[model samples]
Target: MLFFSIYNQKGVPLLYYSLQHYLSLAGSLIFIPLVIVPAMGGTDGDTATVISTMLLISGITTILHSYFGTRLPLVQGSSFVYLAPVLVIMNSREYRNLAENKFKDIMKELQGAIIVGAIFQSVLGCSGLMSLLLRLINPIVVAPTIATVGLAFLSYGFPQASSCVEISIPQILLLLIFTLYLRGVSFSGHRIFQVYAVPLSVAVVWAYAFFLTDGGAYDYKGCNPDIPSSNILSDACREHAFTMKHCRTDASSAWRTAAWVRVPYPLQWGIPTFHLKTSIIMIIVSMIASVDSVGTYHSASLLVISRPPTPGIVSRGIAMEGFCSILAGLWGTGSGSTTLTENVHTIDITKVASRRAVELGALLLILFSFFGKVGALLASIPQALAVSVLCFIWALIVALGLSTLQYGQTSTFRNITIVGLSLFFSLSIPAYFQQYQPDSSFILPSYLVPYAAASNGPVHTGSKEVDFAINGLLSMNMVVAFSVAFILDNTVPGTRQERGVYVWSNVLDLVNDPTLVADFSLPRKVALFFGWAKCIGA
Candidate 1:
């Protein structure tokens, strides 16, 4: 085991880990500006202010997630799951055409939803009801449910890659080359090759941006001569006027207006508007985030400590995620925080699974976010490059989702169809909705109409509450896919082993978990006094 002053179990300082930490932190940090720039486009705040809020909330929550929450080394940072719904809430009819006030109100509604979701998650965690919520999920259900997370983001990811096709294509190529071919290779003298490959590849692309923009550190002339001195990306270097210059970097004249230090106060954007549709959507997304965190917790445990996560750990981790979500909502980030398997993937690349190193990295993320220049620097990144990086990130997530299928032991056609069909249709509904927004032709059956009415999905009777529910349910693509798979997977005849639930369901089996025995010892005693207590954390 490695040990150091910063760490006790591992004594020697592995500079590789320090570098790896920074790169991973930087990679996730870039997304803050990337996500914010789009929302704030043609609106308020500069790169520094937006990034500061993201870093502030993410950093604080990450610390809680690491030390107090799940106590896992997993980094709690930005998430894209809320991206769709947040945009939905922002564009809701209530706030439309409201001008400058629209931006503030939209942000408020988003924040309100986030806070509501957080409270729901906290109760799920602290009360131990989350386990019950996921008891029915198996690999087949999980397969498509998890896959949906990535599939859902394709719309957002593809647009970024398209912004500058030329810049993005090469970045995608390099990311694939590094992650696929070189992540495992090591030179005769160098052993940390796999670990170094990811960050090094990302560094190359980032540096490539500087050269592509103006050759070198504002040489004011890109290195490429043949591409065309007048090319949109290249000429930005020579003339200092980029076709997508702002997209490339966060440096804006507006950033100069940023205060040296910023403190993100609650309701800084505007008064939060509580809408049923948006709130429920965030709650569902937070639940999805919780489920994702379970996988991350399990993966982290297995990868680092060489074992599965105990029920107790899983419970606490989820509870912590809920608390962090509360923080995100209060901070008004328009989204909640969750653990990313990407951080665990980083450990695989580096071969250094040092918990202290990871925790320290989270701390650094919080601290550096205060420095306005850092956000400005990140802001300077080209949009195409950001999109290229997102493409790489989402591809990994897509693969991560697919990898869950291996545990299903999907040999029989019966099982294969379940997985395939779920994915196909899950993908279909979202694509259809994207292609054509909800229209009058898409009508629900009479029995289901009540739910649509309850959620106010399609048909509206002028009740905002009714309409909110309708919109929230329809917008949630994963719910449709998951319900289909869950119903089919459970009802279809397949032996427990064939379904992989024999092993996978152990994740849900609380009776045999010793840690859970101790955890519930006090609760069980308390349950004797109250019948509902049995269900609270049972």
Candidate 2:
């Protein structure tokens, strides 16, 4: 066995083991900011809460998943795939109303939605619903859904990059160079940099950004102690280092004056308030997250274990993700968890797939989260740096989406039509809604928003004004792409072999290997109760 294997004891040094854990933590730290969006005119404490909460949940979830869930080396963290919908719900008309709680009310409702939505996700995994769901999905549906996830978030990355182009552009270029070219290049034949590539590249770019922005003293008030404060809390004094100066002074002055070692517990924000419409939206996000996690499991298993994961582990991973998402809501992180692609890359680069190393990283993250200053320190990273990180990360995401095309017979017209139209409309509809809001009142209902034909089309124009209002939402790229791909793939008939259904179904059958399911399964009655013990394909 390799010295790094969790199942073996091959005598790796303690310091080396610790360094592995540190790299894993660094791999996940960048992801925290992706999930931590402050409210407009919001305070630094608010940002801190977001940062801290994400850290705590991610750390705990990683530990839990390593032990109780997949038992793989996957690191759990804030999911960008789930971000678009939560932002939509946060910006919804009904959610904006707050008597005094302001953004706290927003956090509460988000927490509530996540908690409730997670229940549905858990059911899908624990009750064998995922098996049923997969029977309906093929490469046509999978490719579009996965691809649209990256596409849907395109609006997120570019704007942030453009917001501070001078610093962002250089940062993006630097990060791309480091990860794409410098990656796996041996350092004195020791390969130190290869193992710590993500974090190290981030450190270099961040230092450069810090120098360029001069620690955000130009437009920031809090950075200069001589200047008076801005009353609004979440507002950053400086825009670099995640506006840490702003967070401490304006956002969470109370925290600045408060004690250290503030451990995060459940409901740190407040009781979650579920909204019927908003919860419905989050439920959809949850389902999308489920699919994304399943894909991550399969991909990670193939990379780490030289084969795809059996169906048992896939369902188990999904269930654990849902269960942990409920914890995220209780902890007030506002969104659920998904596997970090970066960490998987880290495993490949380092050639260390030990579960214990990941678990140790989780423990260290949990320890780091107690020092709220750590989150603040991370929060202070420049937006330019953030945009740079997003650019590199999103490129990988887009490539991952495209990778799904390999599963289908891409040369066939049927395959091309399914992939092309779904992808085309997915990008187009969301773009249309963003650019032009129709004035007609024939808009889609809250539940049917994801099912709308097209914003500009003549689906239902009885009330043109309503159509104008809802067009923007109904035309979300993911919703359109997934719905289109799903319907077409199912209704438009082709042979199982031609459609690649046979190959897909064959994967599901791998779950039927009694030894595969039994090898790491929970004891006796518990596994059966959760429906995780059965071989679905058999």
Candidate 1: Cα lDDT at 74: 74
The ten-residue window of minimal lDDT in model 1 covers 445-454
State model 2's lDDT: 0.63
Per-residue lDDT of 1-538 in model 2, one digit per residue for the tens?
2224655543454335545645644534545343445432235555665677777788899988887677788888877766666666555444333345667777887788888888988888777677567667766777787777767656566665565565667766766666667766786554655566557777876666555445543444444432234323434633343443322222234346333667888887778887665666677778877777767776678777666665556667777888899998898876787777667656666666777767666777788788877766666565545655666666667777777777668788888899899999988877656543323324422322332322343335576544523453455676678788889988888767557652223433544456544554445324433345333311
Report, for every candidate in turn, its global Cα lDDT versus the true structure: 0.62, 0.63
Each model's TM-score?
0.81, 0.80
Superposition TM-score, candidate 2 onto the true structure: 0.80
Q: Which candidate is the best by TM-score?
A: 1
**What's the distance in Å from true for residue 105, model 2?**
0.8
